[model samples]
Target: MDNTFARCEDLVFSYDDESRDVLCDVSLSFKRGEFTAVLGHNGCGKSTFAKHLNAILLPCGGSVYVDGIDTKDEERLYDIRQRVGMVFQNPDNQIVATIVEEDVAFALENLGVPPEEIRERVDEALKSVGMYKYRMHSPHQLSGGQKQRVAIAGIIAMRPECIVLDEPTAMLDPIGRREVLKTVKRLNREYGITIILITHYMEEAAMCGRVIVMDKGKVLLDDVPKEVFSKVELLKSVGLDVPQVTELVYELNKYGLGLDQHIITEEECTEALIKLLS
Candidate 1:
């Protein structure tokens, strides 16, 4: 069904002739317009899993279906890529054009989209990412946050059904991180684009509708953010962290504060602390 935009079954992959699996029996599904975050410590295969969504890496022993088309089908690679756009850690690496708008139009142009349509798409995508006013400016002059937004606009110009961002904010400062995160959330809310964000930042994961935590090439937890972050010990055991607010509440709970361990945001933790004091 189209309602389910992406699906992966028993996905297995490894480098160097399949000697070891980076992703082990990983099966997940994404419904249309869902905003989900994937989290894990380093070398946990979260990025590897993201690559499979857009066919950057084919599954070794299983299948990945994007919009019901199999990713393993060599003939359908283009179709699969068109449906799921990928954004990566470094904006500098993704931005290839001199001007912002030209960069956004690059992908569609490569696809041989008509010039008129490419222009229209580029304008819309730039506006969506709040980068339209910088359209003609050289990308070298933009800030890190602005550059990353331009990169996102390029992906949006391709008109993909879903966007898979692998640590998109990792290379950014706080402001840059906020900018990219805000743009992605807006895309999900306004345009109903499915979002799969792979992030090391727990606060970013807290904003998503669902969280999937991977460890040692396998999914360790899959649930709503509050539920996933509540397992403080479990997450810490695997070298991962909860949002700062969640960690604060978790520590308070250990000291007889009796605060809800499920708090994932600063507001929630603050309210809980106030209630305990009262």
Candidate 2:
């Protein structure tokens, strides 16, 4: 059975005709329930490409298909967006309502969903993101991570099959970053929601099942995190970094320590080091 959820076919996009193409000949498919990470330096078109997934930005010369519906189809725009939700870098910008639960129900209310259903969905979404206790509180009272979770809850209330998050943790502190990442992982792992996370954090990318490295509006690499990060030189050439454990392993291998270059996690690196010592 074909499990493809969304796909971009020969996608070409640009801000304007005068500007260079931000996404050039980009073609990829996101399978159902897959957790994928997109990595790139600044202005590499990762965000531009993400916008196409939900019809926020139409392709200049090609097509973006969400569940077989063309994003260019004006009539199905709402359908496309409902299937694929987007979360951006700053949580403050995504939050609209002052109250947490109210914000989650905002979209549903606008869609004219039934009041009873909206209430049920809002509660479920808040609980899913572990922010149920803060539902009655004002969004401003919550921390950065909490705000982001509220943002995510708003999306979840819509029951999206896929989520495209563009650098969702960029403004968060180390602790906040961990909190958001944990919530994202649980969403993908437990709910079976397909995740497309755009981030510059190599460690966060390493946590994903798949990693796609983009440069100059093209995909430089796409594979499992271990295989993709193993090419440290190629990734570095594109101004991208590998996970810290992978970087350590790469340096050790260069010094003839013969460490495994594919070790992306600290636990894997520790095991390899212990074996080397033994």
Candidate 3:
């Protein structure tokens, strides 16, 4: 069988030694070049699961493999980390160097990449995220969105096969959110990078190829955005709200409007409503 990019097989995890498992026998697979969104409420183990992808957290039971390399193997730790780069929520916490280019160069430096190669990779990464012009700027002086892009550039410099973002935009405002999301989507669509995004934002989740909804540490739903959002009751039960447009369509259907069940975008909803009226 061809090796998957990432796989969690019967995985179980818990921070407390004696507490119940935070992730209970959870199993999932992510192929290379796929964009996957993981959604769930707080304490639902979504972040914990993200940590496992890069071997930041080891499974209490079962296993997590990145490109068929077992995460439990200490010898493969560095290899797994280089293969799956992570970006966390807080931009402040992620920035290591004062200068934008220096921050982007940090990870590559640690990996002992040659100085000449580091400069090339850092420049490419900054350009990839549209932050090359800010390479000399101090990270503290940049706007929230710009800073977040620098953080993403830092990860990109590592040249990971997959990037796992854990609530990467949660700390940003609307503009920042859009900027980060657009950058991430472009990376997935254009560069063929596997992206596993863990977020609560319905709109961001909608942009992914597949959505996995978790509740009480287990996956309750795993399907395409349209199919997952169609389950209004199930999503609500897990404390998740569908995209506003999807909810509007669901409510319209309830009142005998008979709109297309797959209407997810605002434009689609508007067109469906017009057809219903006509």
**Model 2, which residues run further than 4 Å from truth?**
none
Best-to-worst order by lDDT is 2, 1, 3
- Candidate 1 Cα errors over 4 Å, as ranges: none
Among residues 3 or more apart in sequence or in different chains, the pairs in candidate 3 whose N, CA or C atoms overlap within 3 Å are none
Q: How far in Å is the alpha carbon of 146 misplaced in model 3?
A: 1.1
Model 1 gets an lDDT of 0.92
Better of 2 and 3 by lDDT: 2
How far is 212's C-alpha from truth in model 3 (Å)? 0.4
Model 2, C-alpha of 187: deviation from truth (Å): 1.2
Clashes of each: 0, 0, 0
Q: Residues 151-237, candidate 1: write the lDDT tens digits.
A: 989999988899999899888999999999999999999999999999988989998999999999999999999999999999999
- Per-residue lDDT over 116-229 for candidate 2, one digit per residue giving the tens place of the 0 to 100 score: 999999999999999999999999999999999999999999999999999999999998899889999999989999999999999999989899988989998899998999
Q: Candidates' TM-scores?
A: 0.97, 0.98, 0.97
lDDT at position 186, candidate 1: 98
Candidate 2, residue 84: Cα displacement in angstroms equals: 0.6
Which portions of model 3 miss their true places by more than 4 Å?
1-3
